[model samples]
Target: MSVDVPRRIVIFRHAKADWSQESDHERPLAERGRRDAPAAGRWLASAGIAPELTLCSSAVRTRETWKLAVHELPQRPRTVYEDRMYEASLGELIALVNETAEDVNELLLVGHNPGMHALADALAGDAEGDALARMNRAGFPTAAIAVLTFQGTWKSVEHGVGRLTAYWSPQE
Candidate 1:
């Protein structure tokens, strides 16, 4: 992709997970999460936000969310199950994004909060209408996805470099 072309980043928080599991990383999605996951996928499809690559956390809940969400897309993008993303800090998450290949125009990150929320807030220096406000109000709930656009190579992605174009939640 040309450096002049805007790159889109879809920051997706994993769906609500079942709390009964002994291991946090092994917990599966709850019934509501199962339903909400597909809704998020449908929204992405309707908005035509097809990512070229997806960097997903290896946690079972996040992986399950990706499985359901990707099913709604026109084509399945390349996906990497990254264990580091399970509970990555904002800086670590940024580093992961920076390592993205230049050829990928759009990238999706399936992970958890508050890293996901922090990344979205930090990157969006500006917003389209009330996108940022609504995101704040929603508190980046489970299965929420924030769409951001920035102009530059993935290596250049940093704080205040992106515009928050859209935000969506299962309740919405």
Candidate 2:
């Protein structure tokens, strides 16, 4: 299939969670995280990057992050929740992106890290700034977003083929 180049994908790691809680999966966003969400959303909007579809982990923090971020975007359909996204690996996340409908040009995936960071590093080709290195060093912070561009279908995206377009963090 001759897919178009420059397909955009945005990956966001869920905001900070309330560690006081017991289970990691059930932890909600911390107050700072709650505050950071809208800021991150605004940053995305300011950059004119909006997702046509949002795929988020069903975890509390992930859902909350999505709700906050989508608020900055134009009206659209509800997000797709994937249970597998809760603690999915980079490979799993890539597979999920590949499964997205071909009609959708832009997509956003919000989930947790190690996986998110790994995916970013995997898809990124010659990351220019300190962003990718910072991401690798500290892990994706709460309310951080990485934008990538692929030259073919998501299924066809491979290492070094996806370009790192941008990276946004709440702290900066």
Candidate 3:
């Protein structure tokens, strides 16, 4: 028999970056980004949800963001550094998620924007609310976290199938 397992996806854009660096991939987090990372962690911890696996981009800012926030998790989760995620398109990200093991009920992805922003909106389905609308308009700013929940395995996830459960940011 097929069993239904609820999957929770926690997606966050890397914290604010230090653009003064010469290379985009090597650019570090700005001072405010540094401060916001742990705040994002604490925000997730406050919600009493911890990821089972975390996928992070290899880019410096994303790595730094994951490092700072991951410390706040109640227990350490397995983390993978994915080079593709650094410049991944939304479709690429989705493909990665589809390959996830079924045992992982909750997963976190820390990456960059435009793709991240587009993914969040595309996956949120028909979810309607002032908060989601507000978030959608903001272009998924740095350190923003969006949570989605759905009853299915990662591979089963399709466009607009997940429901936007919660959305938060350091500014909130």
Q: Rate the local accuracy (lDDT) of all candidates.
A: 0.95, 0.82, 0.88
The clash numbers for all candidates, in the given order, read 0, 0, 0
Model 2 scores what on Cα lDDT?
A: 0.82
Q: lDDT by residue for model 1 over 24-105, one digit each (tens)?
A: 9899999999999999999999999999999999999999999999999999999999998989999999999999999999
Q: Candidate 1 vs. truth: CA RMSD?
A: 1.0
What is the TM-score ranking, best to worst?
Answer: 1, 3, 2
> Pairing residues by index, what is the TM-score of model 3?
0.95
On the 0 to 100 scale, the lDDT of residue 146 in model 3 is 89
Candidate 3 ranges with C-alpha deviation above 4 Å: 1-3
lDDT of 1 at 24: 92
Note the residue pairs that clash in candidate 3.
none
lDDT of model 1 at position 165: 94
Name the Cα RMSD for model 3: 1.4
lDDT tens readout by residue for model 3, 1-172: 1348888888899999998746999999999999999999988999877899999999999999999998897987999999989889989989999989999999999999887887788788856476578778777889999898888888887799788888888877
TM-score of 1: 0.97
Q: List the residue pairs that clash in candidate 1.
A: none
Instruction: Put down candidate 2 lDDT per residue, 21-87, tens digits, no spaces.
Output: 4688788889998898888888888878867788999888899887887787756545898899998
> How good is model 2 by TM-score?
0.91
lDDT preference between candidates 2 and 3, better one: 3
